[model samples]
Target: MSESVLKTLVIYTATLVIAVALASVLILIPAYVHYGEIHIPGSYNALYLSKYSPYKTIVVEIDYQPGMEPTPKTIEALQQQIEMYSGKEVLVYLDQDIEDDEVPAVIYGYDIIKITSMLQEQNRDYRTGWFGGNITLYILYLDTIWQQEDQDYSNRMHAASTKPYSVGVTYAADSIIIFKGSLPQNDMETTILLHELGHVWGFGHTNESSNIMNAEFEVYRNGPSPDDVVETWYPKDFSPAQKEELARLHETMHILALFN
Candidate 1:
């Protein structure tokens, strides 16, 4: 090829390459970064109601193993709680050996997952009362006698942690389990059950024993603290105003991002 023609061709090619590189860097890079920011979870700053409706409810069947039967009053208290959440049906399956004629409920054995799925479909929240589940809970029944280091107690804790139960909306877990060697005092039973359920609802322990989440109860099973009640009953759903507030929040965040 002629030298002049070859030199012209080289200059033209280099110009095209530079233009393409500049265009890509100036346009494509920013577009890609912006695209990525849009698709991230909780991005677009949107508000969403839970797929599960707050109104519907379900109750899991509770059964007591050989050593872990709960009391009639405790069972009744559990039922009252279930009712408080909703008028939806509460089912309790008791061991054939224990008879409580005063408490009006039927107990039967059935598939847990199937039941959970049904509850999910119904958009219901299931409450596990301290007394009912074949799944037994332990409490420091007699503080003087109930040893924390007991092998049996340790084994029970291990089993509860390992055993799979549908504990939350996203995953199933063996929730913190408790067992009482003997019946807890009236005040203690209610407080413990309330506190444990608090944990189930995503509340953590607090220094305040007056709080339901406090571990001061005689038998702290699936209980909630006052904090638990606040956490669990606090409307999880965002109202129209809340949605607006969330949008405002996102706007505020974007505005703040400008300074950063």
Candidate 2:
């Protein structure tokens, strides 16, 4: 082979080797160091911590329907739950109530897809992406009566995490919509909020029902009552595995914040 051709081949081989090594590092680092779970929709792994730093405070913004504002007790319960799991300062902010005319357009049914789409349309600012510390969450409380269309579904789904975590690209503008009439006694509302927040922070559903990330929820129905009160059982707290995952995420966020 000519000298120039041989030199060109060597250079191409070296470049291929370097590219493969770099790709491997990117894929393996998360597996070893644990940078949170990869979201299904976006396939990104990192959870975006607010620019305010989790060590200081994580703000939760609530946008409720008229007269459906979460009670102070519910706020306290949510704060306590977040502090317990994340070991971060919890700050709750009540944003203005969603306009009456916009409520119908925002909530089409109990389906999370439709709700998220409507929310994105009406409030483009709330779309998932990197954002500052003004808000880490945007929860919407639907005061209307609604039910899951699935007949076989046992537990009444109180709320859902509309947006998945996207690494570096998506912020924590994760949304949760709760039906006011569906809440049962106990801190059920708080439970649902924490569960959805877990999803926003890159936690997936668990098989263990006692864990806060449990996939199955037990529905509680009032047998004889004029109001027909109903709610789902709330897990007491996060499992050990979940806490470990969250700790890893916090550490990763701290390291990334340092560079930023």
Candidate 3:
């Protein structure tokens, strides 16, 4: 080959090698972190913390939106579900048009601050994307999780990833789950609730249809299906290494629970 042609080929080969190396690193970093072969703190990994900390306690504030009537069954179901996150304590407040109550169903600016302070004071760990924190709900805002006229229903619905984790603290005050008004007859409310709850417990979406952690809302029962337990990161499934992490986290949760 001519000198120019040989130089061009070498340059292209070098670029290809560099690109492959970067791609390999991108893929391996997560695998290495997940496998316990290497632990990368703060790097995102599929292995998540269990919702219920044997050591720590979590408190939640469920505020309802005005004109949004969730049945007692729904509230009870949510309370029961959250209890799984530490098996110790969870507090739920329900009301409308209040300012900064522990749980304000409706949007009062003061209520937001109150809830935020509670989370901070309690030192809860929350997620960063849609799956973390108490869902900061704005009822009837029309900008949030509401259907628009002429919009495709499938496209408009809330998916797990649609709302990335805004905050990542799990606390007596941090995670805000907001209930918008006029829950549709369909399984929207239940699905969203369960999906968000899945996030709270450190479970990521999976391909299993029977699991609540699936990203899509094909099955929206009031609570977790039997399948959810199989993959949950509770004390039952912890490997030796994961068990250590659980012990440390739970011990911290227990300290917080004393104040609650």
Candidate 4:
């Protein structure tokens, strides 16, 4: 081959290699971010936090299968949690619009997202725009489990027993999925919901076992402290530090609203 042609070939090959690497990063970053494995700084601060959103109204619009719905107590608890996070008025609207028969026994994040497009449009109170309406946060309650694409959680040493430990997931900034079938009762149901809601508000996992944002529950739900428990974290609710931060924001939003 001619020296000039070989030089051009080398340049083209280098350019192609760089292009492939860039494309891989572009794709993998979002996939990891979507799966909650990658944390982006201040991902949803403007939408969920921030002292100056266009409005101070957040609507918790839930879509549930016929057999799986958040209990009244869970509803109240999550409402209070989100209210604290956004420092705004939160309205709860549950729609029993999903059919258990229609849900697949095993699904992934994208599977439910495909269905939410229609659900969001049909939600009577759905409003995610910035102006003239409340911000809508979407949640799905399903009787079946949602298996993550990369999470090999089918078998694990859960705090309770050897069972899958996935209870909830936040696949998008404004969407959460609750594995209603996996929740033994209202307590974990409430805990997992609040945990996912924390994710929506830009909270990342912390090592503090007592903090609500701790990611230990992702591996095992809370159980009585046994000396040999695999995962040691037992988060009852939001930690004091998180609460203080949220309280300051909540108070600021309240004070800001008064001036508006």
Candidate 5:
């Protein structure tokens, strides 16, 4: 080939490669922005809960055994924390005087599968359908002597629904269980509650201690010591990434609801 022709071909090839790369990035950016690495379960295809509506509300029903109920202040703190992180209205109701007949069997060793199955059996009669623009969550506070093998009495056990149930069927309670004995200090109760609620909203344990979603309940921070200190911390709010994930889930649910 002539020298001039070769140079022209090389220039055209470079320009074409750059144009293709730019087009691919433009196509991927919107998907990344909207989804942000969230994976919705297949079962959620039929489930729809709106988190954006002005009337969107989450009703939390607290069923506590004798001497295991959370204090009014603690409940207030939980409500405020959830609202602050999610930007949604939360209504907490104390279901006083829960009888033994209504309480589920307590399983030991932090066995979430067993605990959730028992809750499903106990709350079989409860309705589980979308309430227009609102969502309902149940919480059980029990003093039934629950224990985790690795955790001490000071460490609370908190569990929530890990997956969505069938449409129009309430198989399990979307619940958080707080054992009274686990919460030794009144101040720490709110942090525990927030952590459990984070699970309900599809957040997993994070290594970052500064985040309330951390399973270890400690964050690393600079201190008077030369090295970074592993200080005990309780976040009053969710991390920005956590908040973004929750928002993405809500938006997905809202869009899915339209088709159902």
Candidate 6:
């Protein structure tokens, strides 16, 4: 072959190879996006009505074990409580139930939150930012009892002496466990739900005897006292002090984010 023709052929082949390589690199090139996240500590962030929070809409998820269903009155009262306290639109959803026999007979305090997280992954439908900027309040009603984790003798004695078989316990900022086994199947159900909800709203147990946020249930249980069966004398509601504290939330603007 002539040198000039051969050289021209070599040049064309090299050019074609270079063009193919360039095309492949362009095809494989990635488009990168850099962004930061917001994890509003799960506890009381649900109540703060602030624009900083990514969750503009609040969602409630209730999962029950068989025979542990919350009554209509109880659910209605819960809706009312959230609406009154958060001053935002509220949506409550009854979700998949853990089997009656599947719930652990007794849940220890330390593992309560772990179990709650597992159950949430299993049963929760609406998650943070699922329906646009949103947060979740998860409640599990199980036919089980709660025992404070007492690792040693002193702790056991203290827990035994101070805490009763929990009617309900707040395991996280937004998670509540309703010990259906502990409820008496009356107005107390609604009362206990509100009580646990108070903790989610960042209120501590109170000493006021007539208040729903009292640490102990004996004061309001169906005993011979007139206060028993919360519907009788006083209204089924938070104490004046709790209301006062919650009232301050309107101006308390601390906001955070959740997993998208």
User: Could you give the candidate ranking by lDDT, starting with the highest?
Assistant: 4, 6, 5, 2, 3, 1
lDDT tens per residue, model 1, 1-260: 99999999999999999999998767764453344222222221211111122223333334333444556765676556544432345454444222233111211122323433333333322332222322211111111122233233333422232222111111122122223332223334444444444443334455553454443333233322222221222121223443354345423423112211
Which residue runs of candidate 2 sit more than 4 Å off their true CA positions?
Answer: 6-59, 77-92, 104-112, 124-135, 150-173, 202-209, 214-218, 222-234, 251-260
Q: If the candidates were sorted by their TM-score against the true structure, best first, what order would they fall in?
A: 6, 4, 2, 5, 3, 1
Candidate 6 Cα misplacement greater than 4 A, ranges: 1-42, 45-54, 130-132, 149-163, 218-235, 256-260
Score candidate 5 by TM-score against the native: 0.54
- TM for candidate 4 is 0.65
- Please report the candidate that would top lDDT against the real structure: 4
Per residue, candidate 4 scores C-alpha lDDT tens digits across 170-233 of: 7666777787876654556677888888777657788866667777666553442334335443
Off by over 4 Å in 1: 1-57, 96-176, 182-187, 218-260
- Residue range 101-200, candidate 2, lDDT tens digits: 6655222233545554565457534322222232244567755534334333233233332221111112232555565544555466666666666766
For every candidate in turn, the CA RMSD to the true structure comes to 16.9, 8.8, 15.6, 11.3, 13.9, 12.2
How well does candidate 1 score on lDDT at residue 120?
Answer: 32
> How displaced is residue 114 in candidate 5, in Å?
4.9
Steric clashes per prediction: 25, 1, 31, 0, 0, 1
Better of 1 and 6 by lDDT: 6
> Would you list the C-alpha lDDT of every candidate in the order shown?
0.34, 0.51, 0.37, 0.65, 0.52, 0.63
Candidate 6 yields a Cα-based lDDT of 0.63
Worst 10 residues of 2 by lDDT: 162-171
Please provide, for model 6 over 22-126, each residue's C-alpha lDDT reduced to its tens digit, 9 standing for 90 to 100. 864453211100011111123444333443434556788898887788888889998887777667778888855686555677677666767667777777676
Write model 3 residue lDDT over 93-119, tens digit each, in one string. Answer: 554433333333322323444554553
Give lDDT: candidate 1, residue 199: 43
Which structure is stronger by TM-score: 2 or 3? 2
Instruction: Give the TM-score of each candidate.
Output: 0.34, 0.57, 0.37, 0.65, 0.54, 0.67
Q: Return the TM-score for candidate 1, rounded to 2 decimals.
A: 0.34
